[model samples]
Target: MAEFLANYLPAWLAYMVAGAIHVGLIINLVAVGALVFIWLERKISGRIQDRLGPTRVGGKFGWLQTLADGLKLLTKEDLVPGGADKMLFRIAPYVSFCASIAAFLAIPFAGGDYPFIVQHVNTGVFFVLAVLGLEVFGVILAGYASASKWSLFGAMREAAQVVSYEVPLGLCAVVPVMLAGSLDLVVIGDVQQGWFTNWLIFHDPATFLIFWVYFTCATASVNRAPFDLAEAESELVAGFHTEYSGLRWSFFFMAEYGSMFSVSLLASILFLGGWNGPLPITEWLGLTAANGDIAWYIGQVLGVINVIGKAVAGVCVMMWIRWTLPRLRIDQVMATCLKYCTPLAAAFFLGAVAWQWSLPGRTFFGLLESPAELQSVSEGWSDATAAATDEDEPEASEDQTVSSEPSRKVAAAKLTGAAALQIASTNLQGGK
Candidate 1:
């Protein structure tokens, strides 16, 4: 669409328009997703506690309860403490919300010849983790600027908890990158395209252990229960955002839900098969990139749905954990990360490396072979090797040559393009 617009409009204008559209879509996703999750949390928590939740707001299920709450918040007063640093306090929510939204730029919703990503960064995993870590800064700023002891304490706890958890989180995420041999998330997800056994979580015994570690750290990283010490309402009276109200408080909630969905989607790409389903239904039905453009588009749409479904399922599990388990103390949270998650992630990382080295091309308990397609696509060396093989092959009959030429040319073009991309990515990384 942007390309089409470039024909009629200036290139810069077309790009700006496309970028704005993408931004709007992502913003709506975060806003609407927060609304939905808020309703779900209330309903789910109510059921867990054997009570009805929000029956009066929007009919039987109270579907419009979030909208009602939003209206109420909008009408509430926006107050700044008399002693507060007004500028910092005012800007903090936007900082948090913007940081959460920025992480989605590198996140791909679907994969194909053209993936559904905003920016498509090469080091997507690292970029996301780094951006997510910055969210705590907003909390710290908000707490310190508010001039409240409880808020200051909450901010300090959040800073400590998030910083500590990132260690294990990075370690756990690296296991998949090691197995895939690429830092590009699209390539990582593409490598897992097949049955459920192809998912990184099931690739080996070590990865299975690492997946759990990754989830634990992910939960803590996002400040969810039972690791939500930053917002221990019973103890700290609303924690870091205690003084925040109205739309500003809503921004914090939006940021939280956005981070939740972001981490869940990251998990899907890292440990699950990503946009690919457990079965090869799309492949069987001929709805693949190899088909036609329309077929490819349809396949991509389904891929989006598949990826979103998996992400939503992950969020639901987090909600279940929140309602079912008691919130851990700040001490317990730190101990869980440093003593348990970190060491376990480190051991699992080593085990995964050894397993990959020893087994080579094995997956799923050695019952299936690991796909070499992603490696072949991302490595410039493979293109050189393929060219050499083609040159060394015996001459074929005219009829045979004619029939195979198109496919060979297409393959060569794709390999050359991928190799070029790989080189550019390497240069960019080195420059950084």
Candidate 2:
């Protein structure tokens, strides 16, 4: 994009223009997406409990209700507790909000050679997790600055919960990265482009299991219901934001919703094939870069929709889980993380390693050939080598065919040691 602009404008101006576009798009997506999700959550919860929600406020579906609430918040006076530390109290929410928004900088909304991302950080996963974790520091500051016992307790719970869940969360996240061979989300999504079964979640029994654990930890990490001990309404009176109100309070909620979507986006990119749809309709229709820029443009548009749809589905599931399940005690929450999620994530991680080792080319739980049905190439290499005589021998190609590349590795296991050594010795003598 910058290059295109640079041809018509100054280099610096083109870069500035590119940056502004990214910033604008992300800010709007975060801000507007939160509004939509808030309204959607209310409707979902209402439906679950058998009632109408927010129908009178806007139009048919109460679409404008969240905007109305935003306006109300904007009109309200911002307050700081007299006993609180004014500096941190004033700044904490912005700190959290900024961290939440910054996470999207590394997150790609679509995937391809030129992905829709703000920054293509090499360690994209690492960068996102680190940025997301910084959000709790703001909550900690909010809790401490509020000078209320409830706020303090909420902040401490948040700190402990985030720290604890991060362990299993990181473990589960690593399973996909291990499979994808790159931390770049673009690469991860691209790896699963061919079919739904190629998605990392279905790569093996272990990866399939690991996806669930990841989602469980992510829900807890994001402080969604059943695990939202940080802001337990009955116990903490609004928790870390207890002493907050008005626009500032809204910022904290915005941050929460943003993080919710960010984590969901991350999960989609990792395990659900990011921008790739279940059926590969785009591929089948020949909508790819090779077909021309017009086709590529259409494909990217479809990709954007696929990505947003998957993310929205994930968020709705979270809302469903929130309303359906009763909240757990703090002890139970900690126990759930420690006793179940962590060990299961670790076990799945190990299982993926073993599966990759044993059935190197297998996919879709071994229903298809591992390494994408390369048996013919391996067999052909072995037959040609085995058929070679003591004289007039072909040059050795086993090492090249059966080296560590996953697609080329099946031949190594098939060739006997004596046969391989004989071929190697023949090549050494001939030097042809």
Candidate 3:
């Protein structure tokens, strides 16, 4: 879009205009997502507890309940404790809001030639996770700036909680990246194309286990209920935002909901088949470039719908879990991360590594052989190395590459670990 506009406008202005459009779209997504999720939460909670959640505001379902609530908040007085630091208190909510929404920049809703993403980051998974983590900073600032002991206490818990869970969260995230052999989420999604069984969650027992752990850590990381120690209203009196009110207070909730959706979307892309549906309906419908651009565009639209549906379902599960479970004490929360999630993540990671090493060709999904293109870790790195190189001369001629292939494969196999070492020693003795 910027390139097209550059023909008629200043280059900088064109880029700025394009950026503004993306920002506006993201802002709307955050706003609208918050509205829908809040309403969903009420209805879900109502259903779980056997009650009508919101039946009056927008007709039968009361869809306008959240919108009305937003208006009420807007009319309420914006409050800051007299003791609070003025500047930090004012900016903290926006900080959280910005960080949460920034994660969406790299989250692709659809892929192929025209992916629906504001930024196609190479290390997209890492980038999204890292940016999402930054939301804690905003909470910390709000807590400290408020000059309330309860707020500070809440902030401390959040800091400890988020930092601890990030370990397991990262580990769980890596399992899919490892399986897919790329940090680029589009590539990761592409690798899972074909059948429902091809999804990373079904790749192996290890991956299957880690997906749950990932979901748990994601829940805790976002400060959702059952692990919402940072916002234990019953104990800490509204926690980090104790002194905040009105629309500024609403920003915190907006950030929280937006973060929830972001993590859910990340989970969808990482473990589910992403834009690919269980049945390859698009492919089955002949929605491919072979037909025409219109056909291909329709396929992408289907993909977008597939991914969004998965993400929304993930959000609903979160809402269900939130209302179903009791909030854990801070100690229990920390133990869940350190004593359980982290070790399981580590074990599964090792299992996935061993499984990939020993049975690279096997899959539980089809009980069938993997495709020929499934590369070993060392081969992946070799490809990466070749791509990264910009030497005066080409690194390897075609003949040299062909001749070295078997030896390279052998060497790569030996790079696995202790078993590989023992095998190499046995091979050396046999050769001698």
Candidate 4:
């Protein structure tokens, strides 16, 4: 029976199994992480306001509060509003959820030659950003289809904010990409492999400054607090998904939490050195690509733990910020992005470039390797450069002993006379 099954399946089926494993892992991360975050939010918000939150439902921690809520949502009647565009309204939540899920495909949960990357896109950074941008489409469609004035207003504001913030977000994101020289997230992460100082956040003074800008932009791009004018409960009254209920409503929350985790993952990649922990435990223990054991599942397990630790820490910080700060007005949010974030990000980008040029090998205090120089050195010896240099020299540079005598230009009158003679010969032949 085993032989028969093996014969039926292609040898590459193991890779398919690996892909399925990754998908399962990501889905669990999103679903389980959402459940935990929701419960934590309730408890934290309650404590901040001096109130008990959900002590009755589960235990001292109210661990099962989200599960209970999910149960209730499942049992609730799925209501479609009379004025709603039924098809579009119903489809929007899944769209949002799917977009969030798709963003995970390019995210690497570890660093190594054989890391736990799902799709391994060459343009992984852009793919994540582009897929993330698509999440807003679902929000806009939800608002339009809901046929509610408040929902429409909220969705318009969200669309504008997301679209606007993406500029600074992209600008800030490019700083790390410029420092790393490749858009592949795995490559970017791998570049920051040594110490905590090697992280892009500490690459230079300019990159350090850009880190904060990137954080702010990432927060805004994810529609978190201060920039979350879209779903300001006191103002928009549930916002774009106002008309949504039951399982549909849960889907929007899933998308929101999923996006929160996505941006946290992004931050982890861009600034936190990805799977490279501050302690370097993995490397210290001799678990790297150089060692054959790195190809084993144990390495993957270590990477997953390392990456998730950073990502969860990021998300927790975001939650802390959310609970601590007041939501900013839409105008204030726009002003911050355009007036402050844009110029700061631009200046930092240039400064980092200059720093790389001036101090190519010299690390600040000798704590970290200059990622820029490493990128430059790697690029210098690339096949593309070799090809270009060969193309530039038909003959070797040392062999440039050709004559330097000036070549005479053809006289315009002589060329014209030759043309006329040729034309006359042609005419005579035609006449004959």
lDDT of 3 by residue, 1-432 (tens): 688789999999999998999889888988999999999999999999999899999899999999999999999998888999999999999999999999999998888766778888987888898899899999999999999988987887787777677777877887777776667788778767777777888878898999999999999999999989888999999999999999989999999999999999999899998998998788889997789989998998888889888988999999999889899977688778777987898799778766765666566675555433333432443444456453532422231233224333432332233233334434643664
Candidate 2: stretches off by over 4 Å: 370-432
TM-score of 1: 0.86
lDDT values, one for every candidate: 0.81, 0.80, 0.81, 0.75
lDDT of 1 at 374: 30
Model 4 residue 18 CA deviation in Å: 4.9
Q: What is the TM-score of each candidate against the true structure?
A: 0.86, 0.86, 0.86, 0.82
Question: Which prediction has more favorable TM-score, 3 or 4?
Answer: 3
Q: How many residue pairs clash in all the candidates, one count each?
A: 0, 3, 0, 0
Per-residue C-alpha lDDT of model 1 across residues 1-432, encoded as one tens digit per residue: 589789998999999999899999999989999999899889888888898888888788998999999999999999999999999999999999999999898999987658999888977888898899889988999989999988987887787778777877887878777666566788778888877888888888999989989998999999999988788898889899999999999999999999999999999999998999998778988998788888888888988999989999999889889999999977678778777887898789778766655665667556467666533322322333234454532222221222223333433443354344434434643664
* Model 1, position 119: C-alpha lDDT score: 84
The residue pairs that clash in candidate 4, if any, are none
Of candidate 1, the 10-residue stretch with the lowest lDDT total is 395-404
User: lDDT by residue for model 4 over 1-432, one digit each (tens)?
Assistant: 222345667647755666677788888888898998898788777877897777867878889999999999999998888999999999999999889989999999886677677787977877898799889888988999999877887787777777767766776677666566667788788878777777888878888888889888888888989788778888889889888889999988988889988888888898778887776677678766667763445666876887788888887878778989999987678778767887787788778767766665444546445555344533432423345565643432211111000000111232343334434434643664
Pick the winner on TM-score between candidates 1 and 4. 1
